[model samples]
Target: MELLAWGNTELDSSWSVTEKSNCSYIRIYHLTSGSICYSDTAMSCALDTEAVYILPSHAPFTMKPAPGTDTHCTWLHMNIYPVLVKELLSIPYTQKQALLFSLMRCIMEEAYPPAASLSHCAEIFIQDLYQMGCLEKPDPAFSPVLDYLCVHFSEDISISDTARQFGYTPEHFIRKFKKETGSTPYQFLTGYRMGKCCELLRKGYPVSSVCALTGYHDIKTFDRAFKKYHGRTASEYQKYFKKIYP
Candidate 1:
């Protein structure tokens, strides 16, 4: 995970925004004073002061401060894996304040390289959420399949074969996988492969090698899929990151 942005800010009633679609990064908000309402197509909720709100990536919602009130908040924007939890989570602002501020301090302090510290802090926060049972848990029945995919994503494996290997028929497996993961098996496989492709690319691997390593046989096909996933061609993505990091 990477910290994209962090800050404390005060917003007045005049501040309101509608996000008509999912955002690319997760949002973490620690409300210090006043309140805000978050609404989506399905539900609406008010976030009170002294509470922490976690808005998972790819969740579409709108937020506005209470009328005539000023809301003080510390917020973080992070580039992390799409969290399985889709709903906005409101947790009490207790011991977690230390963790959030620690993350901020990781970026603010120049005593040492911050990359490892930042990741460590973020990982702890995420793990805390999991231990608190705030995140969704995958079905135990599908654990083997998930584990298999992690190890064999580079291999060409058919959905039917995978399902049978785990004692599930193709149709039932597809349904269960979709229900548990919010995506079809093929979609999940493609996403996992694309993630690996990104990791390899960021490590300076050539696009051609990344394609084969991530299970693609044809360069053009890999290019198309990578572009669709990342909104940039493989070579362009590598160049873009190089420019930023160099």
Candidate 2:
């Protein structure tokens, strides 16, 4: 997932937007209040309160405020390849959802310092949509990159090597990567490793395994980084969340 833009938007009776072609990026709108009606040359979808709306790239459409209501929503603009627009279009607007608030929180967190993993948030967003049966395709170009990182993060991988695997030069890769995901490779790796550590620890994996699993050859280094990133030592963090975990 390549993040182009993300934030909140409030639309009133006067609000309207029209897209010509897929417009290079897809937009996902998680409506928190009010309503909206979407239309295209083919058909329309009446989007009501607390719904997720997906506008796929290259699919021309227009969105307008629904009758007599204000609309409040958070939106994410991204490039998700092989988008299942038809599948997304057919989903019920008020379907039960998951990860909406958490994903938003991550987006907000990445907007500030110590900010990491906006890219991961995007991946989670995709995962949620896919889980909800909204997004059907998993052929996005970035999937391989993410999969590789997750499976091999324990190895001493470097940016240039990772970039080359993706068929890009070092300098160009950084620019392209940052543009697509809002994070550098190293930053993403740190966040990814920390996340993996958190998960493994939650699942009763010992810290030593997590150290190797996350590619930290040194226990002390891993401990310090874990503390800094999560604001607690691994033991403490695990203990804190363990009660809530079940």
Best by lDDT: 1
- All models: lDDT? 0.72, 0.66
Query: Taking the tens digit of each residue's C-alpha lDDT, what string does model 2 give over 90-161?
Result: 334433243544556455644241113545666766786688776554346767876787688788888898
Among residues 3 or more apart in sequence or in different chains, the pairs in candidate 2 whose N, CA or C atoms overlap within 3 Å are 22-57, 22-58
At residue 86, give the lDDT of candidate 2: 38
Off by more than 4 A, model 2: 82-99, 102-115, 131-133, 136-246
Q: What local lDDT score does residue 38 receive in model 1, on the 0 to 100 scale? A: 88
Candidate 1 weakest ten by summed lDDT: 108-117
Model 1 residue pairs with clashes: none
List ranges where model 1 is wrong by over 4 Å: 1-38, 45-51, 56-83, 105-113, 243-246
Error of 1 at 227 (Å): 3.4
Q: Per-candidate RMSD vs. true structure? A: 5.0, 11.9
